[model samples]
Target chain A: MSTGAVIEFTSISKRFGGVAAVKDLSFTVEPGRVTGFLGPNGAGKTTSLRILLGLVAASSGTATFGGVRYRDLPHPLKTVGAALEAASFHPGRTARDHLGVYAIAAGLPRTRVMEVLTLVGLAAHAAQRVGGYSLGMRQRLGLAYALLGDPGVLVLDEPINGLDPEGIRWIRGFLRDMAAEGRTVLVSSHLLSEVQQSVDDVVIIARGELVHLGPLSSLDTDAAPQTIVESPDREALAAALTAAGITFSIGRTGLLAATGDPALLGHLAFTAGVELSVLHRQKAGLEDSFLALVGGGHTL
Target chain B: MTMFLRSVSAEFAKIFTTRLWWILAIVLFGYIGLLAGGLAALFAGIQTGVISPDAVNTGGGPTDFGSLPPLIYSFASSVGYVFPVLLGALATTGEFRHQTLTPTFLATPRRGLVLGAKTVTLVLIGAGFGVVALAASVGIGGGVLSAFGVDALLQGAETWLLVARTLLAMGLWAAIGVGLGALVPNQVASIVIVLAFTQFVEPLLRLAASFLEVTAKIGNFLPGAASDALVGASVFTMASPAGTAPLDWWQGGLVLLGYALIATVIGYAVSWKRDVT
Candidate 1:
């Protein structure tokens, strides 16, 4: 298998008429890892992917696979495989016929079509027309098309949207396995939760601008961790937290402390002679942090 | 060169895999066969004195028995040309309708090459449609003419020349369809334009232009007229005043080609290069 190349988007922007669809977006996806491109609806994720694949012209800046633009690549399909969000098959064509068209156009062997069909678990349905395919089967067929050339880099948009839970689970492992083979995998979804477990790193965008780009774990670090603390002496606990210069807010369950370390709060409470019934570290959920980073107004 | 050949092959595959091509060809066959056979029988009946010209009221009827064979053969291009045009337009518009251009561009990054391959493929398929159409017109129409005691003239070189020219005309019509479809990627809009222009707009314009000497000269340049001129005969053109002459065959071919080229170039510049998504 060919190893993945770095996918780089440098200061890319696209405007349709006067409306800016993508604005000064820049990021790089490294090889041997799955990168989740998370964004809200109409956040220009599809446009960015399209630009990277040379389907859309960027208003300014460049997107390249490794060091070369997608259009300039001599063997584009061999180097990179892309399935856009709106990429669709002709309903009249059978799955095999659909892949066969690309395979022939790209000069790939006919056997590759069957190989990829089996890879995506669509071997049995290869003879069936796409008009009869369910959404999940269509998604698999798209993946099969992406794998036809056994490309080093795979780019899929909203790959898990209509999958059953089992299908979603299968894809998560499939993505990881592809990355494990040293291929760069960039999967996009509007909901972070959809890809939270599958992705090692994330490139989050909202309203056409990059909000965050780093390891998935790093996103949590930016969010200030809190501790949920409570006691029978609620008033005394509040007074103790105030005297200790630690910020605290009352919640339905307890006083929400500004400290991440529960032990520190416990020690402070002990020193203040406040009997604490509860003192636990509250880890910020990645979903909450994702919404906060992008502003909580839009639905994921 | 190999890549281009593969692209063309892929385009051919794209068309054959769908039922639309054969469906349209069958329709063309049936439609042209019935009309050509019916007309050949009626005209041959009059020429042979079996049916009175007065009863038909064809204005003393066709006096040129020699022109009948070529005229009937030309029906493949003159009347049945729309099938190939519709086929070609649908091929391009279907890509846009199904959003298949995404994968197409992904496989072949050079947009120009894809368009070129489509043009070449559609031209060939259009010629194939021409063959089916001619099979009907020449086979059924010739049989009818022979049965009515009018010479079928199937063995004549002129008749074969008309057949070849009809094939060429249909291929060019297909190219024009591709150009129009590329120029208007919307399926419904492209189809509407094709039907409206071919069935209503151009025919009316051609009829209206034939009334005036100055306009008649210009009318010969219209796609349908040029196609008829290329085929060397047309039932519709037989109604026009004899003073309004058709252009030479090669000139007619060039005029048809010019229409295809202009539409393709403008479409390439305006829409083909635009963002597909």
Candidate 2:
């Protein structure tokens, strides 16, 4: 497995008429990791991917693969495999025949078509026309097409949309394995929880702007975990918090919230002679962090 | 050159893999065969005197009702042109309808090259339709004429020229069909527009133009009129007033080619540059 290319989007913006689909979107997807492109349905995730693939011209800025434009790649398929949509196929052609067209276009051998078909577990249905394929099969066929060229980087958009639970689990493991092989894997979806276990990095965007981007591990590290404390004498605890210059806010749940070492908060509470009924460090999960970052009204 | 050939081969695979070509081919044979057989029977009736000479002879100049081989040969191309046009239109619009254009463009990002390959493929397929139409016309019409003891003149050089010109005309119509597809990627709309133009619009305009001096000169440049002239003979030409004459054979070919070129250029301008998604 080779170290995959870095996908860089530098200040890219796209506008469809008066609506700005994407604006000043900038991020870097490093090699050897699965990066989840998270955003809502109208968040321009598909448009950005389309722009990167050279299907749609950007209104401004550049999206490059390993520092080169997608259009200028000597062999685009060899460098990057993109499965932007599951329905990008003719219904009349069989699975093998559909792959054969791309295989020929990319100058690959006929055997590669069979190889990819087998890899995607579509070998049994190779002769089946795509029109008869279920949504899950179409998704698998799209993946097979992406793997045809044995590309270094893989881009899949909402790959798990129509999949059953088993299929989704299989895809998650498959994506992780691809990343383990040193290929850059970028998977886009509105649901972060679906890709939570598979991705190493998360790039969150909302309304066409980057809201947060970094490793999933480091995402919670940016802010200290809040130390939640509840006391029988709320007034005394509040007064002590103010006098010690340990500013805190009252949560909707009637608990005092303060960010610091949990032990330190305990020490302060003891020193202030405040009797506490409850005291614990509240660690924010990725889902909460994502919702907070994107704001209210949007679900996980 | 190798890339172009590969694109062409991929295109050929796309057409043959689907049942569209076979259905269209069958329709072409059936349509041309009906025209040839029906006309042959009419002329056979005239020769046998089952239809009176007064009833056959109309106001137009003397037409050899039973003896003319050129009219039978002309049906192979002039009346058969629409099938190739439908095939060409379907070839392009089918991609849009089925959403296959996305993958095709993804494989060959150069949109112009893909269109070029399709144009070349459709033209060849159109010429194939020409050959089938010619074979049906000659086989059925020639047999009927010979059975009626009329001189079908199937052995003459003029008859072969008609055959050659018919093939060229069908090829051009195929190109024109591709142009229409490019301009209008919507399958139903392209079919409706192509059918309406070839069947009702152009024929009526041509007939209406037959009365006006300037419109007639301009109408000679109409695609169907040019196609009619390219084949060198048609029922319309046989029935038209004597003063109205279409362009010469070479000129008609040029005029048809011009429509295709203009259509392709405009199509590229309007739709090719737009994003696939």
Who wins the lDDT comparison? Answer: 1
Candidate 1 segments whose C-alpha is farther than 4 A from its true place = A229-255, A264-279, B59-66
Task: For residues A1-300, write the lDDT of model 2, one tens digit per residue.
Answer: 235999999999999999999999999998899999998788889999999988899999899999988878877777888898889888988999998987777677889999998988899999999999999999999999888889899999999999989989999999999998999999998887889989999999888999999998856753646778878898898887788787778975445566646677678779999998878877767777787777745753
TM-score for each prediction? 0.94, 0.89
RMSD of 2: 3.9
lDDT, model 1: 0.90
Chain B TM-scores of the candidates: 0.97, 0.94
Worst lDDT 10-window in candidate 1 chain B: B58-67
* DockQ (CA atoms), all models: 0.80, 0.55
User: How far out, in Å, is residue B41 in model 1?
Assistant: 0.9
lDDT of 1 by residue, A1-300 (tens): 566999999999999999999999999999999999998888999999999999999999999999899999888889998777534999999999999999999999999998999998999999999999998999999988888888999999999988899999999999999999999999999898999999999999999999999999977863588899999999999998999899988888899999888999999889999999988888788888888888885963
- Candidate 2 local distance difference test against the native: 0.85
